[model samples]
Target: MNREAGMILISTMLMLALLALLVVSQMQTVFLVYKSLNRLVDKHQSFYQLEMIAQKLSSFNNNQLQAACLVTEKNPDEVFTLLKNGKACSLSYEQQSFFYLIEELGFFPCMQTVKEKGIYSTQHWRLTVLAKDERFNFLQLRIARIAPFIRCEKKPLVFIHTGIISWRYLVR
Candidate 1:
């Protein structure tokens, strides 16, 4: 072969190699982005499930409260049975399957008494819910309830009270 032809062939091969490297690098970046997006979607779904559980608890009426309270306190094991037995309550609406791995759960009571107008005697109780999944870390839910105490006389009056309490979260 001629000298000029040989040099052209060498240059063309080098250019092809560089082009292949660039393409591979671009593909790797795209793959990493796709993986990150998938992880984010999974995390969002898990968080949605957790929030739904909280909302369900919030919507509980007196009857539901009494039932759940009794089950949890008296027969803790039965709480799962009530949740899973699927005999009386509607579990379809709450996405029960996603929460099947709940690791911890509980409910607590709180009270406040008003001795005078615009005053309150405050007390606190805690209800805790905990769950863990392989896809995510520990998830915990805590609900706080407040009730006012009053004395009955010829006439009864209600008092207003305000306070802020904080709870802590632990992950394992």
Candidate 2:
């Protein structure tokens, strides 16, 4: 009887030890999952913020964008620099900050008659948007496709001879 009682106690202790280890392992897994979810949420928030900034920047007339293109530096990282005319291109939405560059990709000849509405050659531009938030930093830089504009005049109207080619998101 004594031997049987001793064996049962040892078995019970081993079982309890295994249960404790399992509980600990489960706890570690739960913590890891929680951290990953938190990071995902932050990234989601930042993505939307960047999109909003890009839209706002792209929603401007060519003259406005041209004026805002004060920073002539081709490097995107140089956007953070304090420039003599940087404020023209800088934007603040809610709690986020943004900077955009309007680079003239190239120009193509228009097929339309040069007489109708004075339609001339078309120009392509790239609007590169950079956003930062004190609360949620941007996950990636957004490139907004403004349009391939058929220049109507030197004033550079936004929609007189323009159409949205496409708006695709680039992530990296």
Candidate 3:
């Protein structure tokens, strides 16, 4: 009877040990999941903030936008200074800062004015945005926009040609 009792006690302890290990592994998995989910949320928030900044940049006047941009080749591979106005946005994390750089890729010549009403031209612009945070999380966004502008002779009226505008957004 005593031998049988000892065997039963050992078996129970072994089962408990295995159960404990399984529980610990499950807890670790849950923690990992939580961490990944948190990172995903942060990335999503960063993307949306960049989108808002892009919209703001697109709405700026041509001259103001030109003044704020750096002219670059269509295939820029070097680093350049960002204009001071790039840091004017209010959307940022506590330990993070957001900056943007605009590059005017090309401006095609305006079509010859036949009518007295107006002349039209198309401009190609690229906007690049970067967000850096304390956690070493970095986000970059690139937007390519083709803006058509119309100028009138009578009143010096300038209008953005909304009908032919094209925009492309990319995130990295």
Candidate 4:
């Protein structure tokens, strides 16, 4: 081949290699971003699931369930023991495989608010919830302080009193 033609071929080969490298680098970056986004989505969904589980547990009104939770407060191991015997009263909402503990912290009068004139007593309960998903190797631990009003107001009061007072997380 002529000298000029050989020079052109060599320069073109170098440019093609550089272009391929850039494309590979870009693809790697995109793949990493996709993986991180998937992880973020998993964390977000797990958090929401934990919150929903907490809400369902806090709204429990069953006497036997409450008594069982009290048992757990004194000794958490009792929960596993009861669960093994299929006699636990702790609420499990779905087949998601989750467990929660309820501990009665204290009770006090409700906060004085401009909207509501009559303020009665409120029960302070601490709820610790743990959820596990073996498929994704995911586990989340969340703790919340929930206060459900002890007294009902006239006209069926409509509000959410038990939610998101405190939260902690453990992701694996």
Candidate 5:
């Protein structure tokens, strides 16, 4: 009877040790999952912010869009503050940030017959967008666009032109 009691106590201690280890491992897995989810949330927020900016840019006129692109080209690392309600908007708690660059890509002649009488010019632009969160997890996109505008006109009519995205893709 004494031997049986001793065996039972030892078995109980081993079982308790195994249970503790299992619980510890489960807690670690939970922590890892939580961290991954948190990162995913941050990335989604950054992507949403970037999408908003892209949508706004798409709506902008040629001059406004070009100006913004030039600013990005001048300083690639520039953190542009968005304007809201006539004021500069601040970043959210997730520290989501994004910037875009526009490069002059070679333009192809849309019309074969281009005489001196033709007054319209088509320009292609290569746009690169980079978005990041606080953790530096970044998303990159490349867009090719064609913008047609009148270079010079005698009339006072101000013709507005919007760029059309020819090709776009995620870089990384």
Candidate 6:
């Protein structure tokens, strides 16, 4: 009887130890899952903010000489002023809000000037956008151009003109 009681006590202790280990592992898994989910949420928020900033930048006219001039100044300290839907505005990104800036601007030509002598002055705009959140960061660069201008002759000539206007982004 004494031997049986001792064996039972030892078995009970072993079972309790196993249960504690299982519980600890489960808790660790739960914690890791929660951390991953939080990171995902932060990434999603950053993407949303970046998309918003891109849309806002896209709405501006690429042909606007004034805006292009502002870009040429290349002043990191100067905030480019823009008018959207008749309202004056500027872009900013913040942790609680969204933060954005124009990183680069340049001209992209569609065709070789030597080959197409007067076909088009230039052909594409390159815009680089950077987006960031607590967990992740994204860089999106896009080339944009005006609709092709068609010239009818013995052969139709198409000319597309574009210039780098602005790059925008948001960070949190």
**For candidate 1, lDDT tens digit of each residue in 70-127?**
2323243443343334322232334333222221223212233445343333433232
Give Cα-based local distance difference scores for all models.
0.44, 0.55, 0.53, 0.55, 0.48, 0.46
lDDT of 2 by residue, 1-172 (tens): 9999999999999999999999999999999999999989987777777777766655656665456563343553443332222443666778666665665555544322233455445545556665544441322232333233454444534332343344554443
Which regions in candidate 6 have their CA more than 4 angstroms from the true location?
Answer: 62-90, 93-122, 132-136, 147-172
Using all chains and alpha carbons, the TM-scores for the candidates as numbered come to 0.54, 0.62, 0.63, 0.62, 0.56, 0.55
Query: Among these predicted structures, which one has the highest TM-score?
Result: 3
Worst 10 residues of 2 by lDDT: 136-145
lDDT of 4: 0.55
RMSD of each: 8.1, 7.0, 7.6, 7.8, 9.2, 8.4
Q: Give the Å shift of residue 151 in candidate 5.
A: 17
What is the lDDT, from 0 to 100, of the residue 95 in candidate 6? 49
**Cα lDDT of model 6 by residue, 91-170, tens digit:** 46664333233333443333322233444333443332344223324333344444344334454443333333334343
The TM-score obtained by model 1 is: 0.54
- In terms of lDDT, the poorest run of 10 residues in model 1 is 100-109
lDDT of 4 at 136: 25
| Model 4: lowest-lDDT 10 consecutive positions | 136-145
Q: Which pairs of residues collide in candidate 6?
A: 93-98, 93-99, 93-100, 94-98, 94-99, 100-169
- Tell me model 6's lDDT, rounded to 2 decimals: 0.46
TM-score rank, highest first?
Answer: 3, 2, 4, 5, 6, 1
How big is the positional error of residue 65 in model 6, measured in Å on the Cα after superposition?
Answer: 8.1
Q: What is the lDDT of residue 9 in candidate 1?
A: 97
